[model samples]
Target chain A: MSDDARDEETVTVAHGGGTGRTRDFLEDSVVPRFGGDADGLAVGLDALDDGAVHEVGDRSVVVTTDSHVVSPLSFPGGDIGRLAVSGTVNDLAVMGATEPLSLTCSLVVEEGVSVGLLEDVLDSMQAACEAAGCAVTTGDTKVMGSGDVDGVVINTTGVGVLPQGAHVPDAGLSPGDKLVVSGPVGDHGITLLAEREGFDIEGDLTSDVAPVNDLVAAALDAGTVTAMTDPTRGGLSTALNEMARKADVGALVDETAVPVRDSVAATGELLGIDPFDVANEGTVVFGVDAATADAVVDALRATPLGAEAAVVGEAVTEHTGRVVLDTGFGRRYLSEPEGEQLPRIC
Target chain B: MSDDARDEETVTVAHGGGTGRTRDFLEDSVVPRFGGDADGLAVGLDALDDGAVHEVGDRSVVVTTDSHVVSPLSFPGGDIGRLAVSGTVNDLAVMGATEPLSLTCSLVVEEGVSVGLLEDVLDSMQAACEAAGCAVTTGDTKVMGSGDVDGVVINTTGVGVLPQGAHVPDAGLSPGDKLVVSGPVGDHGITLLAEREGFDIEGDLTSDVAPVNDLVAAALDAGTVTAMTDPTRGGLSTALNEMARKADVGALVDETAVPVRDSVAATGELLGIDPFDVANEGTVVFGVDAATADAVVDALRATPLGAEAAVVGEAVTEHTGRVVLDTGFGRRYLSEPEGEQLPRIC
Candidate 1:
């Protein structure tokens, strides 16, 4: 009945912020209806992980879906097409399914969009799939009357296969595990925000929207990745808090070691935003055994996409379900974002 | 270069009509990019079939995705929620994958929609999934600023499995194959149109929107189904034309044999729309071996969802790639509906 109480209220933008409010909405409104764990599922809606792992006969089938409603359609470094494909692929990658067996795309377009735009989007999608070593095998397209939808909203679903019992969960971390990041965070969210607001930052503010499955596969090959997740909507801070809470551990981040582009940091400071609380399209966070953390970072750095990899933090025994930031001056608790500071960024 | 010629043109409602225009756009823009056949695909984008069949190791994986942007979200018999789930389920069922292994949902909602409305819609989706014996294992949610989206648009992707070589393609029909229909057509399209236009027809004008996977499975078990497709967008005419063209054969239909509800026929006449050219959410068309056509019809009729199943036509040796209808008084070619006469009907 408590869940039903929220039904009377209208949806707020913060409900989809990908932070505490988002989780609260999901737990109250969605989880009760169909999010409970189901049989044949290694990872179901209850886990709220990157993707769901279904145990088929001798194969672990990973499935994930994302709806990209990014504003501006085209951005600094990538467009909606690349973001859509990479989002689903990364979700699968984080679940230990680096090779996508199949991908499906569904497009909802507003009337009057130029065919040239659609073609460009499709080309971007094709190129991204090729980079991921996959293809769009099935798709559906619907056109709404003008203003019924934004310029375009894309939904992509990815299916991948991993060896049985090989899939990873975001909640698999244990105390004393080292936290590793594939690259600089907040590039995507900050770039899109700057572009939308017409802010001209000096340094490179391009979005880091690329497929990171290859980077993930290399890391998985090098070390024991107890847990993995992409810092997407709510950025590194939200992802770290989720991992800590789900694993019943705490995280202590060395702020100096976390990768951040100078331009991104400057823009965040100017805009009164935290780089850690934004989004990164082509980045991954790993909870790895302390002994193999350096090896995992080295393996990631070997890849073009993960050249800026670093060990940013560690899972700790104290302050379970919290994230503590060591800014090198003093330690402070890093809170999960309460609402979306920048919506429609991805 | 010819494909690029259309790039300069703006997208019209006809571009997404699920008819000749839609096929042309796909061939010109999409096919050139990624619709070509790929390795390890039993049924790929080129086929434009119900779904794509990926040869995964030893098992055949069937994947399909659909975006539901039906206007007036709730209709006479079903809402967008049921339509979304049933649409994906039927697509997989037509491909010989009646048992869905996983389903993913992605929702794009306007900022001010009521949570109560979403709850009702989710309840409908849950019931539909339960009917299809599937679960929503993974999903994503995004909220747009008010007016960026109409209300809520749902995209659902279904992943299913059949034994390798067991899946069917829409182009598998042959000469002498019997054509069968699950039940009366035109209900969904006519009902939606009536609701949109505020026409108070004096009869049961309900949309036949239900998951028909069980009926399809029973029919497949009873007879040899060489080809199959569900009539969702351009209705039975478009589906039959596609089957004939893909198989490089002709079809001869007995107009009287096609089942259309009396009220639907009356409504179609009132609106100057052909019943055969309107959509039916829960109806299926089958190309069966003539020897087993009677048994297949019987099996379908035994199910509550297919009590009106009937043999409507047969593939013929003449008039290659065309469909001819015998009206008892005369005969004429049945053309694919040129554009969506009713936009956003599905």
Candidate 2:
């Protein structure tokens, strides 16, 4: 490309929109230099899984990192601190590491932010760590000049251990596998969008931001979890699509079976956003054995966080690498989200 | 504090200056909630050391995190990518983990950043990883709306391994320990300050930014490393004071012995900055047993990166928790840096 064209090649929100665009950027620029995987790593960048599982003395150590720049810092139900901790912990949980060994937090705060607000955020983070049975063992802090950053951006890295043969990848799904979702979807994204845009919806539209490792542990104890991933940036549609493409299998979802809170659905309708395409922090989609599907659902439903658990889909051989959504009246393909639906919704 | 007074409490650049103000913030706001150490951690947040050492079975796993937000992106000798990787890697190295097992990177880019520039940065990061003999196993990328963030901010977390009793802490110095500096001081801070301020110096002023794990490993092999810390943010003065205060000993320094490049010395004089009070990214200050101090210096000098290695000081019991400088004519106390010598020097 010429200089003019290259200069015009600026990044858009879509590049980080957790869709095909994001995947394209990674595969083109990052994967080539960094490579997909390295020696002694069970799940490296190539898999694009929730975490990287490093092999050490016949044991698997999972490591993952995420940077959170959610707007407003404080939301209706949760704030950036809570979101930062839960996002990392949930990533580890989905990678079959239910209990994180430790976590490292790095905070980049813009000048002029109130210390009181920072304290509140730190308190929320500590509370979340306690809830997840983990702690922030080490952290780094940096301050930038005014206007260099908005509020604060937090980056967290988590480390955990998984049994040798128990390593789970998002691409481990089979054609006969059943899929289940732990509780309602879209609550986190819809609530944040409403709160940011000042929708003033009637019902309570609190964010479902939480760490779901406890619920995942319960599910694992009940049945076999073949593949798992948390619906985050691109929501359920993008997550299911990724699993299908990576596993080379098709996903058939019963639209009516996917749980959605009444308030979230109404708010999403008001905003013209599909709940399935919105983000969720405290939800997980698990691919399980057909024989243990109901058992997993029962196990999830037994917990408070998973009270709304349901069997939403199944892996199939037909329509490989596609997600088929059955809307009761008809069936259509669920395409991955294209661009930024709501940026900084994490 | 009242609401108005609390609201007036805003974070300034000094809070992140790596000086007394930074120490106060960590102790008052962060350390209280996060605590100083935990059960399995050998050195936790409270010590304010280089990294956290988590005891896993009979071995120690060192983990550290750092976020880089240097302006101009590309500088004389290095860029943010190399700085981010080297910063995290050195943290682990100073904690007695010379070989990093893996690293995780998180990038937060503002809209309008050029893709080519990003590719260049990633290439630099890969090169730094290769130099340090490590690889990035996993990473995340997020883009914020324009005006929400500056050009780009990179956060990296490194994990490494050490033996059961080989963990090093910045506070492990004793009364009779000797201090060794690997190379010249203030190269990184002075070079960036001059570059950012558009100063045309006569001599070459390249940043001494590098991964000095090999140099540190060599020093360790030649002597008993009682304590170690990198003079990153507040230069040699702050690091020595921290060691003295934490270990309850006094540091006596020979002012003429510390190494300072001629270009750096001239630039520091022009900028009204003291070389001892500025940052150095590619250097290390070691507290070693007095018996093997010469051997440690010899080992460090044998390495290409540590030709200027010198024994600059020693720990003494006379004036506990202080640093005294002997100028060959008179002796005076060297106070810790107050605040914000040069913002974003890293």
lDDT of 2 at A280: 92
- Per-residue lDDT of model 1, residues A91-203, tens digit only: 99999999998888888888999888988899899999999998898898889999888798999999999889999999988998999999999899989898887884684
Against the reference, the lDDT scores of all candidates come to 0.91, 0.90
Docking category of candidate 1: high
Q: Give the DockQ of candidate 1.
A: 0.81
Residue A20 displacement in candidate 2 (angstroms):
1.6
lDDT tens readout by residue for model 2, B1-346: 7867766799989988889887888888888887755678787788788988888777788889999988879889999999999999999999999999889989899999998889889999999999998888888989999999999899999988777768889988898899999999989988989998887377499888899999999999999999999999999989888889989999999989999998888988999988899888899999999999999999999999899999999999988999999989999998877979688877
Native interface contact recovery, model 1: 0.82
Q: Report the backbone clash tally of model 2.
A: 2
Q: Clashing pairs in model 2?
A: A36-A46, B36-B46
The root-mean-square deviation over C-alpha atoms between each candidate and the true structure, in angstroms, is: 1.3, 1.3
Docking category of candidate 2: medium
Residue B288, candidate 2: alpha-carbon lDDT: 96
Candidate 2 lDDT over A17-89, as tens digits, reads: 7777889888988878876556688888888899888887656788999999998798988999999999999
